[model samples]
Target: MAQEPDPERLRALEARLAEAKGSKAKPAAAGKDFSQAEVAWRMVLELTSGIMIGGSIGYGLDYLFGTRPILLIVFLLFGFAAGIRTVMGTARDMQERQLRAQAIETQAEHSAGTEG
Candidate 1:
């Protein structure tokens, strides 16, 4: 005949299952944390790429027009302006994100304070 399961063993299994589920329910915090260095690097890359792309386009135009230094100089300045604009945009985005994060943290704290 088949035997019945023991009550103690069933409780132990349920406890372990609940513990595992609880652990998994917590959000993964590792990916969200961006260090200052990483943020700076991201901004720097954005600016650099903008400048490089602008400079390349300018260089190509100068070569096509046979204007030599004139177009090159103009384009280089344009590229610098474009890069500054991109960097400013990146800074604004980062600021907005930081504000939102702070708001969330503040809300969470307020809720916790109210609960206790």
Candidate 2:
């Protein structure tokens, strides 16, 4: 036969656990840093993919048309331009997001300051 558990000990354990949980600081900025890294990678990939796709298209057209290097060069330039454009757009979007976040943070701080 098993003995009954002590209620007093269980209550003490629960209290200790609660205190431990409450004492740990949350890593609030860790997630934001990871997301920023992801965005940067996304921008790099978008630029690289754009250039690759354009180059491939140009190569294929050149081969079919028998225009040799002429078409390939032109297409390569186009691809580079497209990639740059895409990168610029992504940068703009990132800037906008940063500005918005700053504005929100500023507003929150203002509200908090006013409250106290």
Candidate 3:
């Protein structure tokens, strides 16, 4: 006579299978759900922070040197330039990351196709 299967073990196996199926469907939806607003906000934050930090440093230096306005104005402009540079750098980095991610995904698909 064949041995009876354990109900507890069978339930555990079913639960694992369901969990695996659920997980496989989530990542695609998560990727699609990513918003452009997030990227915009990230760049804005980077640019704003750079400008603020540079301006503060310039102001401090001006105060220390007892120069009323010249260094402050110069450093403020420098800070604005720095902020723009930072935003551009951030944009480039983001593009690179996106390209890398796409390349990885393409490679994965190719390998999967070959294997199948």
Which one is best on lDDT? Answer: 2
| Shift in Å, residue 24, candidate 3 | 7.8
Model 2 regions lying over 4 Å from their true place? 1-34
Error of 2 at 13 (Å): 32
The list of candidate 3 runs beyond 4 A from truth reads 1-34
Q: Per-residue lDDT tens digits of candidate 1, residues 21-92?
A: 874233446247678899899888977887788778878998898887787778778888888888899789
- Give one digit per residue, the lDDT tens place, for model 2 in 2-100: 999999998788778778888534335634533778888988898888888888988999899998888888888888888889989988977877887
In candidate 2, the residue pairs with backbone N, CA or C atoms under 3 Å apart (3 or more residues apart, or in different chains) clash, namely none
Checking candidate 1 for backbone clashes, the offending pairs are none
Q: State TM-scores per candidate.
A: 0.69, 0.67, 0.60
Candidate 1, residue 53: lDDT: 81
Off by over 4 Å in 1: 1-31
Weakest 10 consecutive residues of candidate 2 by summed lDDT:
25-34
- The backbone clash count of each candidate, in order, is 0, 0, 0
Task: Name the candidate, 1 or 2, with the larger lDDT value.
Answer: 2
